[model samples]
Target: MKRMKKVAALLLAVVMLASTAACSSDKSWAAKNDSLTVPIGSYIYELYAAYYSASSQTGDTAAGSASSQAAESSVLDRKIDGKDAKTWIREKALNSTKSLFVIDRKMKDLKLTLTDAEKASIKTNTDSSWANYKSTLEGYGIAESSYQLAAAEYSAKYQKVFQATYGKSGAKAVPDDELKSFFEKNYTDFSYVLCKLYKTDSSGNYSASFTDSEKKKAEAEFNDYASKISAGTMTLQQAADAYKSVDSTISVQNDTANLKTNLQGYPDDLVKLLDGMKAGETKAAEISSGYLYILATKNDIAKKTADEMKTDDGRNNLLADYKGQEFSDEISKEADSISGVTINEKAIDSYDPSMFAAEK
Candidate 1:
């Protein structure tokens, strides 16, 4: 996850420069022609990462047919549910690009207040994350003050948006009980293995992309991996370690996510696949041609009823997760209303999503 982010920082400075990042917005974005402009700012760092990740994972699934081709070679092979790769990546990029702008604008529009501590923490986290890749950032001409300011206000901005929608009390603070209730109703704690399939050469370079034959072979490999988990021969971590070889492409990572069933945050195919799945079930799901060998360590049980949610002290800690989703949806909705949010197609086209792929 952090790998793509490092690659993104390098791309944004070179590819997402202001001259290309400034694009025109359509109706909801601008009521009058040229009245509203979406400019390139520090936000591109976030958007670039999102677009890159989405494009890599989704591939060309978005195209009407698997063979659908775009002139831009960058996305010629990628998909997002059969949609065009460029189309999908651009949409994701646009959302990340517009998120901060809308959040800050709405904060002013609603006159929300941020507590002093919240302000300080945002800055602190932003500075820390930035420092990890400070050289890459500065190489791209990102000023420390600019990066810090964007990083610092991140929490405060989103908190304001979430509070507005959830109807929080203190300037926009959500009541703990109601927040807990939302959590109890929304999320399920689960862990999964994201098995990204590829064919590796001796040099550890991903040589063969997922083709029809590769997909079948990859499925077999993942099935065996799943069998190991079911038989208790290996845990997910051990499985990840067990299969890593010089010429294998089935890279594994064990991840835990408190996923939401009702939200359309990820692909619908993914959400539906997990529905009613029980713990101890090792299921395989293919996204595009690659595989997601889902060994569900937990499942989405029943959501808490109104009263049950209020009294569910066990899950109160999940409030942050629900709040975060609500905030993201709000920003997405705001972007949706805008008829036009133009990206520099030429600039966007120039980017190669494979830069994040396994290198030799």
Candidate 2:
């Protein structure tokens, strides 16, 4: 009977050991599943995570670097560092999340309510934006799921913000004082010359399109204008107006800050040239489309009195501080309540140019 009792006791110990091992295994499985969930509070954080995953997986920082080095398509690059293009979906996702958060919080503060129409507008805008985002990503050979994930993350994060802020009120009208201040701060002086050149593009080479002969003549004219200003023969405004006589439709507006609100795709070189020159200065810039004559004009803004300036500055500082506080409060609350947080290290390391290779 004692021997039998010893055998039974041994069996009981084994059973208990097995049960403990099973329990531990179950816990690990649960944790792994939980880690697969992504947080939905900030698209920026999601993008950062995504980029980190890609960067970690490929051991190629060049994926991101290639984007930065890209001149026109830098918009598509997802580079975290160096010369790669930063991913637009990731960046916009982060921005959308932040914007939604801010808007939602504002609604809560103002006790505003969102109407059905407003909600519809928001939904429509969101849908449109996502569609554009996906299309753009596809053009660069990025996976559709990746783009969808980005939009999803942004939607989830901003929805929470909307619920809290403008979700109730929809769109809020800008206050007069606020609008005026924004306008004044952003408004600046600008000038441009409109020219009509007989167009020609040769062998699909834009440079070659402007035959060497025509280029020489245009360059000479540009130089003549530049020399006139340097010699004080004519001001930028005078030169542009004079040139307009050659082509009545080719009027030049010099030393003006306000551009038509509809002028899209303004050349960056023009902006830079304008900013670099004095009010009376003239510069000739060559663009892919055609030759441009730009003139700089003086800008005069009304300065506030010392006291007034102080008051304005102080108000701005206070407003900024309040915004910071509100954002922190809202984000902290959501973060604490977030259910899933993940970091995909392997995916990030593998995120280099090699990923762009044909799938094996």
Task: Give the Cα-based TM-score of candidate 1 against the true structure.
Answer: 0.44
lDDT of 1: 0.53
**What does the lDDT come to for candidate 2?**
0.45
TM-score top scorer: 1
Backbone clashes under 3 angstroms, per model? 17, 51
Kindly list the per-residue Cα lDDT of model 1 for residues 1-360, writing each as its tens digit: 799998989888777665444532211121111333433334344434654466456552332223323323444345667877656665676565556556666677778767788777877787788778677555434456546544567556775566565543444566766665565445554555555566567786667666777667666776787777778787666665655662244344333334554443644555666655664666666753343334334433343334334543433334446566666776788866654444444443444433322211
TM values, all candidates: 0.44, 0.41
The TM-score of candidate 2 is 0.41
